[model samples]
Each structure stands twice: as structure tokens, then as C-alpha cells.
Target: MNRPHYILLPVNPYFITFSLACAFLLNLMPWGRLIGVPDFVALVLLFWNVHQPRKVGMGIAFFLGLLMDVHDASLLGEHALAYTLLSYGAITIHRRVLWMPRGVQVFAVAPLLVVAQLVPFVTRLLMGAAFPGWGYLVHGFVEAALWPLACTLLLMPQRRPANPDDTRPI
Candidate 1:
């Protein structure tokens, strides 16, 4: 018996930047009235951090988080701190997380997202900002829940045809 072999296509750096830009724009979109809108930029950054740690690491996450702070007019360095920690966590587990199946990967990443969210929330609290209540955590959960979908969409461009001769049974 022969099993189909699939090869992953190389991803362009420009495509990754473009996707991150799109996620930033999505985050900027007005959804103030909504209760639990996910953080698109953080989600994208985390995804890239896990899949391409060499290309997307702490510096990019910090820069992007700073940009997000300016976009949202939030406390300076709040998002930067969170995103930096998030990137660190992702990079630390990049190999292990990549080894897991997609479904398990989602769960594995949830705590990282939560920690990312917690950083900003804690920063705000220390700065005299009022607690936003448990509702604030919903966004992290939403981001985690959408992980599978985001991975599928982002990887679509990287799917390539397998070599005909490479198909072999184990």
C-alpha cells in the first residue's frame, strides 16, 4: 500500500508581513459595542511565533504590541510587555507545540494567550485602572477557540503538491 505524502510550500516573508498587517487592521476596526471581540493581532503574532520562530520573535511581537497600544490609545508598553512574554512562551515551546496535532495545539496555546492577556490587565490594575471584570478573559478564550481556523487559513498558502515518488507505505 502507498500513502500520500504532502510537502509544505515555502512561505514568503512578505506574505507573513501582509497577514500581520491585516490582523492589525482587523484589530483597529471599531467593535467597541461588542462584548467579546478577540485580539486579532495577538492571535496572528502567536501563530507566526509558533510556526516561524526564526522570522517572528520577541522584537516583532514587541513592535507590533507597541503599535497596537498606539492604535488603541491604551497605556504605553502594556501590550508590548504582554506580547513580548507571549512570544517568549511561544518560542520556548515552538518545537513541542508543532509536534502536537492541531486540536491539541489549540489547547496547549490557550494558557499562553491567557498569560498574554493577563500582563496588560495586570499592568492596568497597577496603574490605577479599574478592573474590567471576568468578562475581559473571554477574548483570550475566543482567540484560542479560533486557533484552528486561523492555522488552516494561514497554512493554505503553504500547501504544495507532494513529489510523486515520495509516496510510500510505512
Candidate 2:
């Protein structure tokens, strides 16, 4: 079976900002501080970084990181550092990942997502915080699992149906 290729329309800057804002807001929701809640901002950020690197660069990631830092009230630069690295890694391999099947792409990015989560874990550990449990790391993979849905929803506005034969944008 062949993967469907999309000829996406130019993404609107406003839409990007709006989506980021929505993701941030989602992260703000109180889920009893659940470990499995997923870092929604990171998910959306990586998506935009991979799909629209030029528009959503590291600076945006850094800024969002700062916002998350303030919200989380953890180490000041923890999220900034993690998000920066995540953005860098995504931008680095975006070309290859984009060409990959979604399932394969999940495996490719899972490590990156784990590392992104690990940065803050190590940071807290360095500051004398105790282990947050392995579930913390598992959250990264949980976030990574959302990749396919994120790609579909995020790309929806930009995607145009190529043909009747193709049911969804691969």
C-alpha cells in the first residue's frame, strides 16, 4: 500500500498562534496533576516544528517554555531547556520523519519526547528532588502516541482532498 501525500496549503500564522494557545490552555487544565495528562504544549510544539519549522522555530518554543515554566512553577528554565532540545531534535530530523509512515515516525520521536521529559527530571534531581517515578518517563511515550491524532487535527485546515480514493491524509 502507498501512503497518501498531501499538498498542504500555506499555513496561516494566526492559525498557528491560535493552535499553540489552545494547546497551552489545555496544558493549564487541572487534571489533578496527573502524570499521564501529557504535555500538550510539547505535542503541539513538536508538530508545528516538524510541519512548519520556519514559522515555529526554537524561539517560539523557548518562549512557550518560559510560559510553561511560570505555570508549572518548577525550575525556571527546565521546560525552556527541554522544549528547546525537543524543537532542535524535531527540526533536525523533520525531513526524514515527514517522509516516514506515522507508526514509524512515532518510534523515531518517542526517544526525543522521552529525552525532553528527562531533562526536567534530571534538572529536578540535580536540585535535590527525589525520583518522580518511571511513570514520568512513560508520560513522554504517552505524548508520543498522540502524534498521529495531532498530525491529523493540526494539518486538517491545511489539507485538501487529493482524490476520492484516498480516505484520509496519510
Candidate 3:
């Protein structure tokens, strides 16, 4: 079923804050070498890209990515570049995702997520950082696996209203 685009403005800020908190929490979650959690921030951004492109797009992703870089103390601009590219790609494909089944949308986003991770890894390697090894890709796998849940949790039909004016635009 097609979903509405009405936004919930008054409550939107709280949701964004909650999502951002979730992002940081997910980032802090500890996992052994075998499995790593996906970038919760990126996943949240992607959901917004597909369902609320007008509200959250490249700029937000880039800004958040920079925050991540500072918080994580990783290579400078590493997350920023990946986020910029991924957000751009997401926005570019935003319209197409609207008609796609949730599964199909996950398929479409999974690779982009993987590629986004890879870019920073490669950039770090180029800058003389030690290779992180195959385990580095674990986050991608987690991201793909978590796709449906993320969509359901963040993209609920009631969350989107058909009329933009019905709720807050952002």
C-alpha cells in the first residue's frame, strides 16, 4: 500500500533526537570479531532518505558523519566522504524506492551501505592505516540483516501523512 507523506512536526524533533541517540548507542554496542553492528546513524539516515527525502538528505548525513568521525576518533573525513556519497546515492534513488517492496528496497540499499563502509576503509589504508581485514565487512552484513526491522521501526505508515501540511515538514 502507498503511504502518506504528512509529517509530524511537533514530535519530529524528539524522534530525531531519539534516532540519533539510538545511532550512538548502536555504535557503542560491543560485538566480538565475528559480527559487528551496522552504522545505526547511516541506517536511520537511509530510512529518512527513502521515506522522508524532503526532510533528511545529504546535508544531514554529512553533518552527522562528521560528528561520528569526531566521536569515534577515526581518520578525518573518512566517515564524511562515505556519508556524503551514500546520502547522495540514497537521495538519487529516493523516488524509485517508494514503489519498491521493502525487501527490494533493502537489496538496493545493502550494497550502497557496504560500499560506503569500504570507502573509508580503503581511504584509511591509503593513508597508511593498517588493513582492518575481512571482519571489517561485518557491519555491512548486519546492516543488510537489520534492514526490514529498521524500515518497520522508522518508516511506519502512520508516521507519514499524505498531506505535507498535515504534519511538520521536517
| Local distance difference test, each candidate | 0.88, 0.90, 0.76
Q: Which whole-number lDDT from 0 to 100 does residue 113 have in model 1?
A: 93
Candidate 1 TM-score versus the reference: 0.90
Cα miss at 46, model 2 (Å)?
0.4
What is the alpha-carbon lDDT of model 2 when measured against the actual structure? 0.90
What is the overall TM-score of model 2 with all chains considered together? Answer: 0.91
Which sections of candidate 3 miss by over 4 Å? 1-11, 30-34, 157-170
The model with the greater lDDT, 1 or 2, is 2
The sequence of per-residue lDDT tens digits that candidate 2 reaches over residues 7-86 is 78889899999999999999999884577888989999999999899999999989999999999898899999999999
User: Of models 1 and 3, which has the larger TM-score?
Assistant: 1
**How does each model score on TM-score?**
0.90, 0.91, 0.80
Of the candidates shown, which would achieve the greatest TM-score relative to the real structure?
Answer: 2
lDDT of 2 at 123: 96
Candidate 3 local Cα displacement, residue 127, angstroms: 0.5
What is the lDDT, from 0 to 100, of the residue 37 in candidate 3?
58
What is the alpha-carbon lDDT of model 3 when measured against the actual structure?
A: 0.76
